[model samples]
Target: MVVALFNLVSALAGCVLLVVAGGDSVGMPNEWLARTPFPSWAWPGLILGVIVGGTQLVALIAQRRRYVLAWGPHAASGLVMMIWIFVEIAPLLVWSPLHGVYFLTELVQTVLAVLALGAWPQPFFARMPRRSRTGVGNTTDTPA
Candidate 1:
């Protein structure tokens, strides 16, 4: 439950960042992303944010299912967010003559993504059964 909420928050935050940092007018962190070659990638990031955030929202609705389909989308979106942050965003922030705000925001968002994935209920929640493995063959209870 907590993981989902964190993911949702992070996704929303990321979306806001992408929207606000659409162009190169700003400086440092914000401008860093905007200056990247494929400026259009921001749109994908925004879409990913919506997907991740929506996944969490659905998780809340389907609590009793033990596992929800949202997990896959959440994980994919997280990966995309990480790629954008590290590959495109980080370089600019690191090399450019920018302030620390961009780095700090990146750090916080990274932590949130880590926590969300680490705390996810379980990857196999839906496919696996609850029963424990006995590891005993009915034909031969004794060791061969």
Candidate 2:
């Protein structure tokens, strides 16, 4: 839910960026794109809203729906967010506190997904009986 909200806000922000970029390029300066391969923030805004935002939103939905490999999307979305931030700063050649905030957020998102996916010794799914032939249950010897 947190990731979904983040993505939603990002998408809205991106859309706002698109609208602003398409217009007078108000708060955002065209000079920022001078070092990059863009004439304006229009393309970046679109990519943010569509690609970054879209992928995260889809991941959130997949998680909610209990889709198979939902964690994959969650992880992927985090990667996208991190990558977007990296690319965003590369051309600008400057840093902002918000970048650190967002980068950390996405990193946490990815870590949480990995933990939820049982990156540690916790079971991701229900355990079978102790004496089961498959022997895929938890290793702890404590009695149920």
Candidate 3:
């Protein structure tokens, strides 16, 4: 449920970014992207939202729960993206005192994905049990 909710939000956030970039550039300002005449972050956020958010929403809705492949290497992928804007390309190469709406939304999406996989080791990220030839679920222990 949480994953799905975040996914939906990400998609909507992405759409908002595209709209603001094209129609209301002044609504949200980011010193990093403002350096360029073109609103560079919007396009990438739009793309990420469509791809990552769309599939995650669908998978969660269908209860497929393909966490490992859902986001194409999952949280690692999100981390990589956040790094580009928050680290390498971002001014001062450190955390910004204030982040734009787009950056915050993406950061939320990334945090959500990582938290789900890391929590409880099962509840949010429950995996199907594998069966052994004996017709019982696989266990960590072996008959001694």
Candidate 4:
């Protein structure tokens, strides 16, 4: 429950970051034409915000003891968030010229968000017992 709340909060924060960052430049047609000059961080941040927000929101709604869509997307989004964090950090570490305080800030935020999602309690479906070959529920036997 606590983890879910954390994820929700983090998702909201991500959305705020997206709005403050000026959204995705690539999403704007004029960007490709070079008519508008937006920071490179805009696009990736916006993408990350949407993905993370959607995932967390779904998880939160599902946690409320309601029907949840596929858990696959939620898990995938968590993984994507981690990947996005790496993507954000890579340039800063590989290219000294890109060093900035914002890089570290993003790193911390991403780490926190990942930790929150990791700590969330497993859904009942995830913890449910599987059926054995004999057609009985197998709570302890490992599948071969």
Best by TM-score: 2
Return the top candidate by lDDT: 2
TM-score of 2: 0.77
Query: Could you give candidate 4's per-residue lDDT for residues 31-129 as a string of tens digits?
Result: 432422345445544665677656656655664654444343445545555565566445433333322333443344445555545655566345545
- Candidate 4 segments whose C-alpha is farther than 4 A from its true place: 21-40, 68-74, 94-144
TM-score of predicted model 3?
0.38
Q: lDDT value for candidate 3?
A: 0.53
Q: Is candidate 1 or candidate 2 better by TM-score?
A: 2
Encode model 2's per-residue lDDT on 65-114: one tens digit a residue.
99988888888889988999999888788787888988988898889888
RMSD of 1: 8.6
Candidate 1 lands at a TM-score of 0.41
List the lowest-lDDT window of 10 residues for candidate 2. Answer: 19-28
**Pairs that clash in candidate 4:** none
- What is the clash count for each candidate, in the order shown? 0, 0, 0, 0
Q: Supply candidate 3's per-residue lDDT for 124.
A: 50
Q: Which stretches of candidate 3 lie over 4 Å from their true place?
A: 20-26, 30-42, 51-55, 58-144
Per-residue CA lDDT of model 3 for 1-144, tens digit only, reads 563565457566756665556424634345556554555566656655666565555545444554454543345444544554554344534344334543565566566666655644645555656568898877644432
Ranking by lDDT: 2, 3, 1, 4
Computed on alpha carbons, the lDDT of every model, listed in order, comes to: 0.51, 0.78, 0.53, 0.50
Task: Give lDDT tens digits, candidate 1, residues 76-139.
Answer: 4445444544664455645442223343443454455455556655654544333336744344
